[model samples]
Every structure is written in C-alpha cells, then in structure tokens.
Target: MKNDFEDKMADIMLGEAVTALLDEDVAISWAALTDRLRSAIEIETDEDRIRAGLRAIEEVRREMHVRNGEKTEGKRVAALTEQKLH
Candidate 1:
C-alpha cells in the first residue's frame, strides 16, 4: 500500500513537471520541448506520442499568434484614451 501511494505521488509530480515544462516550451523557449522530442525519437520509445505532443503545442502557438495579431489589428484604429473637453 505504501509503495502504491508513493508511486501515485511520483506520477502526479511528474505530470505537473511535464505540464510546466510544456508551458515554458510553448511560451518562452522550445529547448525543453526539442530536447524531449529528440530523446523520444532517439530512444524509440514512443515517437508517435512525442510527435503528437509537438503538434498540439504548435497548434496552440499558432492560434495564440493569430489571436494576438487580431487583437492588435482591432486596436490599431481605436483610441487609447478618451478625449474630454473641460
């Protein structure tokens, strides 16, 4: 029972770490993602899984970029501050 509990805890921690790492990879740097991908391919453990993860991250990034551009474009012709006459 103790061993099972410990295993579950480790799994949770590992999942959290991977999530954080993926966030960083998508937001700031892709080094973590690249390294993980290369390792996965080299080890031949689960290339399909690794590729899927990469594709998902890429799609999210693409959507974010598109949304950001739309937001900026929408604000381009809008006034930032209201003009008030005293």
Candidate 2:
C-alpha cells in the first residue's frame, strides 16, 4: 500500500468483499472472507493478485486485532494471551 495504485486496489477489493458479505450472517473469519472473495468476485488467481488481496485482508485483520487490545506481530498473532480487551 505504499503506492496510490496499491491502495486503490486494496480499497476497491475490500469494498467488494464487504459488500459480498452484507446479506449474510456468516462469521467474520478470515477463511470466510477469503472464500467470499473467491466465490463472489471473479478474482484472477495470479500470485500477485492473491498476494495483493492478502495484503488488503491483513489490514482489516490487523485493525480488528488491535481494536480487541491484542497487539501482535507476525507469528505472535496466533499466541495472543488473555488481556484487558477494550
């Protein structure tokens, strides 16, 4: 997202992903989100596109994680300990 084009791509893709899930009551899991993006949007499965989309997805995931008061990086994300979640 260092460039405008990458940011725009992430924003547009994120919007589509969010919209694809608006009518459902599915859990907000990463797997669910990825599946929705795959099925609902005709994403070209090129490695670069997948990587870019993953980068965008990580933004949302990171925000949610930080909002839940769990600060982590890389592999530490999965080992999140019980903390005072706001």
Candidate 3:
C-alpha cells in the first residue's frame, strides 16, 4: 500500500502530463506542472521526491509529443539517422 502522499504525487504528475498531451500545449503543461511542484512543498513532500516527480512528468510530456506526431526534434533526428544510414 502506497502512502496517500505518494498516490497524490503520482496523480498530479501524470494528470498534468496527460492534460498537456491532450491540449498539445507545452507552455501550459509546463506552467501547470510548475504550479503543482510549488504546491507540493506546501503539502510537505520532500524536495528530492518533488524533483523526481517533475522529471517524470517532463518525460511523459515529451513522450506525448512523440506519440502525437508533434515532435519536430524527433523528426529532425529521424532525418539525421536516415542520412547517416544511407
């Protein structure tokens, strides 16, 4: 059984990322996550844990961009890879 704090942290992290993915708005997603991270201090979550959660949330956001075909960086990388392979 996870601590309630842990569950809430997970929810915030994933929820923010999922929302951002759906909206396809990176700026808004980052802003919301930053707000959630700041609020975590008020909720007594440790700094290390909050940082880890933030990193995970960022990863989720990036993955969402990739999956949604909104990753221009990924496309550039793919092109580079193809050029090298040829």
RMSD values for the candidates in order, in angstroms, are 9.3, 7.5, 7.1
TM-scores for all candidates: the values are: 0.41, 0.53, 0.33
lDDT of 3 by residue, 1-86 (tens): 45566656666666755575568654555556656544554564576467547655655577666776757778889999999999
**Candidate 3 collision pairs:** none
Kindly list the per-residue Cα lDDT of model 2 for residues 38-66, writing each as its tens digit.
Answer: 65435566655565576677777777778
lDDT of predicted model 2: 0.65
Better of 1 and 2 by lDDT: 2
In model 2, the number of clashes is 0
Question: What does candidate 1's lDDT look like per residue over 3-34, in tens digits?
Answer: 46545544443354367676777553445544
CA-RMSD of model 2: 7.5
Model-by-model lDDT, in order?
0.52, 0.65, 0.63
Using TM-score as the measure, the top candidate is: 2
Cα lDDT over the full model 1: 0.52
